[model samples]
Target chain A: QKEVEQDPGPLSVPEGAIVSLNCTYSNSAFQYFMWYRQYSRKGPELLMYTYSSGNKEDGRFTAQVDKSSKYISLFIRDSQPSDSATYLCAMSRGDSNYQLIWGAGTKLIIKP
Target chain B: DTAVSQTPKYLVTQMGNDKSIKCEQNLGHDTMYWYKQDSKKFLKIMFSYNNKELIINETVPNRFSPKSPDKAHLNLHINSLELGDSAVYFCASSWGQGGADTQYFGPGTRLTVL
Candidate 1:
């Protein structure tokens, strides 16, 4: 099994709807969970990250991690058309620091 | 200023050819990484450098090589590029160390090997 597993979703949602993107990992050693947003022709940019199992919120985005279940999620509330992009989930065993394991990414489309 | 920058934003060349993609970070970061995103949108780590020293080298082909001349720069050189090498290559840097350190990524180099 892949270290990180994320559904490569082209999930379409209407503007203002809540969007939830999720990832599951087989490695319990992953301590850092990150969500990245990537637009067309652009590189993935880190949106938010959390080192613990609780949820971290920033404006319209929230990142949740369940270390016991090895699951992570990114929630976008009041989603806008500008939220249309690929969302990538990444994790690292803090020990290596830069050795990040990234998922296949989920493509989200927020329609007007 | 752009935190991370990569040269030749778009690279297109024939198979078996040689090419290089350069990356530079103005964030004064000590760690840098090279990641490849394929057409399927799967991002995989190729190599990483910490202060101009090799740190993480993934299970990539030998034709691909990474060089870090300094802490602020990491260049990816493909000796004999194959069609499979066509993908979007991204350069990223972190402030200090560990995944907790937010990584800033470059705009990405889209390489198309025909």
Candidate 2:
């Protein structure tokens, strides 16, 4: 099994709808969780970041992490057509190497 | 002012040819990284440098080599590239090597190996 698993979803949602993207990992040592948004033909950009098991909110975006279940989620409230992109989840153990294990991004389309 | 930038935005090269991708960050960051995103959008770290020193090196083939001339520059050179080397390469920089440090990524270099 991959260290981090995420559904490569072309999840289509109507504008103004709420969108939830999730990722599951088998590693228990992950302490830092992050969500990145990538547009077509562009590099990934950091969206939300959270440490350990808790929720962090930034405007319309909320990031939640549950260490016990090895699960992480990113929720988008009142999504817009401009939010259409690939959402990628990444985690790290906070070790010296500080290498991030990334999930296969989920493609989200917020239709107008 | 771009925080992170890469040269040769699009590169198309024949198999067995050598090429290089250059990365520079004006953010004065202490850490830089090289990542490869395959056609499936699976991003993987290939190498990392901290203070111009090699810190994280993944199990990439020897054909790939990363050089750090200074804290602001990290370059990747591939020798005798293969067809499998076609992918999007990204350069990222952060203030430090900590896991929580926010990384700024470049626009990425799309390489096509024929």
Candidate 3:
């Protein structure tokens, strides 16, 4: 099994609808979880980051981490067409020099 | 001003040829990294440097080498590239060490080895 798993979904949703993206990992030592958004033909841009478990919210976006279940989620509320992008989940063990283990990104499309 | 810049936004070369992708960051970051995104969109870390010193070199083949002559530059040189080497290469930089540091990525260079 891959260390980090995410569905490569061309998930479609209406504008203003709430969208949820998730990732599951096999490594219990992964303490830092991150969400990155990548537009077409561009590099991944860091969106949300969290340490350990719990939820962190910024504007209409929220990131949740469930360490017990080895799951992490990124919720986008009132999505817009401009929000359409590939979302990548990454995790690291938080060692001194951390190298990220990234998931196969989920492609999301917010229809107008 | 662009924080991170990469030359040859698109690279096309024949198999068995040599190529190099240059990366530079004006962010004054201490840590730099190279990541490869395959056609399947699977990203893997290929190499990392700290202040021009090699820190992490992943399981990539020896044909791939990362050179950092200064803290602001990290370049990847591929010798006798193969078909499998065709992928998007990204250069990233972070302010410090550890997982907590936020990495800033450059616009990737898409390499096609035919």
Write one digit per residue (lDDT tens) for candidate 3, span A1-112: 9999999998999999999999999999998999999998998899999999999999999999999999999999999999999999998987877788899999999999
Summed over model 2, clashes come to: 0
Q: Which parts of model 1 are misplaced by more than 4 Å?
A: none
Model 2 C-alpha lDDT per residue in residues A1-112, reported as the tens digit of each score: 9999999988999999999999999999899999999999998999998988999999999999989999999999999999999999999888876788899999999999
- Encode model 2's per-residue lDDT on B10-69: one tens digit a residue: 999999999999999999899999999999999999999999999989999999999999
Writing each residue's lDDT as its tens digit, candidate 1 over B3-98 gives: 899999999999999999999999899999999989999988888888998888889999999999899999999998899999999999987566
Cα deviation in Å at residue A34, candidate 3?
0.8
Cα lDDT tens digits for candidate 1, A1-112: 8999999989999999999999999998888889999999998888998986999999999999999898999999999999999999998888754477889999999999
Please tell me which model should have the higher DockQ, number 1 or number 3: 3
TM-score, one value per model: 0.96, 0.97, 0.97
Candidate 1 whole-model C-alpha lDDT, 0 to 1? 0.91
User: What TM-score would chain A of each candidate receive against the reference chain A?
Assistant: 0.97, 0.98, 0.98
Considering the true interface contacts (CA pairs under 8 Å between chains A and B), give the fraction that model 1 also has: 0.77
Worst 10 residues of 1 chain A by lDDT: A92-101
